[model samples]
Target: PKEDRERRGVTDGLLRLSVGIEDCDDLIADLRQAIERSARR
Candidate 1:
């Protein structure tokens, strides 16, 4: 399965998040922070 996923372009750094019933602004802020943090790395 790991090989298959990698073959399909799903590598180890792929992020899969499930959004629940949370505030849109909060989600946006969290996502922005996460993206910024990852970009810095």
Candidate 2:
């Protein structure tokens, strides 16, 4: 399962987001917050 997941671009350093049916500004703000949160770690 791990090998198959990696072959399909599901790596540790990869962030894949599938957002749908959400407001544009809200998504942008959420992304900015996530980036800020991760940077603090």
Using lDDT as the measure, the top candidate is 1
lDDT of 1 by residue, 2-25 (tens): 999999999999988999999999
**Runs off by more than 4 Å, candidate 2:** 1-3
Error of 1 at 23 (Å): 0.4
Model 2 Cα displacement at 37 (Å)? 0.9
Which digits, one per residue and each the tens of the lDDT, describe model 2 over residues 1-41?
87898999898788789999899999999999999999999
Worst 10 residues of 1 by lDDT: 9-18
Instruction: State in Å the error of residue 13, model 2.
Output: 1.0
- Which residue runs does candidate 1 get wrong by more than 4 Å? 3-13
lDDT of model number 2: 0.93
> Would you estimate the TM-scores of all the predictions?
0.65, 0.69
